[model samples]
Target: MHCLEVNDLVHRYRNGDVVLDGVTLRIPAGSIYGFLGPNGAGKTTTLRLILGLIALQHGAISIFGLQLAAHRIDILRRVGSLIESPSLYDHLTATENLALLQAVHRVDEAKIGDVLDLVGLAGTHRKKVGEFSLGMKQRLAIAVALLHEPELLILDEPTNGLDPNGIVEMRALLTRLNRERGLTIVISSHLLAEIERLATHVGIIHRGRVLFEGTLDELQRRRRTHVALATNDDERAIALLARQSIAATIADGRIVMPAMPNTAIAQVNRRLVDAGLDVHELHTAGDDLEAIFMNLVSN
Candidate 1:
């Protein structure tokens, strides 16, 4: 079942500039939906409209079968969100800040420790939010957001300023939250690698419009698979593939095919050998998330 739905969502600035135009999405329950787009692409604006922070110019949004605008407070009770940045009191300790939110939301105090541990901040609960590192603070923000254990988790740029370790930890936490707790997550991020690692579904937005929405495999099928093969006879291999009119490029003593089936690589290898070319290595270097993102945005 779809936990969140948006239909023809249209939002514009007061200057009549359309920030979101005819945006629509259906986020399945218990799925990690990656809301991907570059900066100034209206990702945040669409999130705001869904959360009821701004009035929709046209269209409709519903959370868990309830209209977002009409049932604002009640519907929001089941959703937790962290927008562009963390909203926490710098003066308060991590635990204290989370406790304050617990008070406001009427969530149990016992949940504070559980969430802290869940986000891998159990040891830093007493640390002051002001003194924590950017990554640490981001974890605390997620901890606070999860204190109430809402069904849906909304996070924007959750790994904006983290080192490798922090990024891995955040990814693991998100995966666990989704897999173990069965929580639905809607994450907006520019880090394609991070999204690819965590999200089960993807929705690509550009200039306030949703360009693509589907599963990882579905997205991959739309894109071309690239492979790079290295050989001693670079000139011969290039000449051989080019003669067949294969779409290939050369870089660093290797021939690259922008799009070809896996089985075709064998034929190319056979052709190279038949041409008296010495094949050194045949390996597949599939396009990464960045490549996929660029292709979508460019198209």
Candidate 2:
């Protein structure tokens, strides 16, 4: 089942600036969906619309088979969100902060301990939130979100200000939450490399539209590998490759062609040699998620 679905979503600010334009997305249940885009690409706007933090202007949003318009409160009850940053009372102890959320949400106080441990912040219960590290505070925020036992968690740039170690810890924690608790998470960030490590599915948004949405494998498959070969006679090498129906282009003073198997590459090398074109260097290079993201946004 799809955990969330948004179709033809269009959102504009009161100032008349269109931020989300016909954005559509489908996130399957039990999957980690990475919502990726550059700054000002409307990623946060879409998340807010989904969570009912903002009124829906021109689109349909469905979560867990319920229409968001008619079931705003009911749907929101099943979702936990941390947008941009987690809101916390710095003066309060970790446990005290959670106690406040428990009272507001009316969640069982017993859940506090469980969530703190789940987020690796159990030992910090006596510590004031103001004294906690940024990473610890982030974890505490996640604990607050989980206090209600929501099935879906939406985080916007959860690792925005973390050090390298903090990033890794957050990634591991999210993965564990998905695996152990069966939570469906939709995380948004512009960091392609980070998402590449954690997401099973991805949606690339740019200028308020989704440019690509598919499994990580699908995105990787779309990125073609190419053989970069340096030859003494570029034109001659191109002609020789064309005679064999292989397309080639000259880039950075080297001949580049679609990647083939090792045997095929060897045959090309031999053909170039036989045609009197001296092959100097040859290697295979493939585009990564960062390259794919750049290409999509640039277009």
The Cα local distance difference test for each model comes to: 0.87, 0.92
User: Worst ten-residue run, lDDT, model 1?
Assistant: 217-226
Q: Could you tell me how far off, in angstroms, the CA of residue 295 lies in candidate 2 after the best superposition? A: 1.8
Per-model TM-score, in order, reads: 0.89, 0.89
Q: Indicate which candidate wins on lDDT.
A: 2
RMSD of each: 2.5, 2.6
The best candidate by TM-score is 2
For model 2, how does the per-residue alpha-carbon lDDT over 207-233 read when each residue is reduced to its tens digit?
999999999999998786899999888
The regions of model 1 sitting more than 4 angstroms off are 226-229, 240-253, 257-271, 282-286
Could you tell me the lDDT of residue 224 within candidate 1?
A: 58
The whole-model C-alpha lDDT of candidate 1 against the native structure comes to 0.87
Candidate 2 wrong stretches, greater than 4 Å: 230-254, 260-264, 271-281
Per-model clash counts, in order, read 0, 0
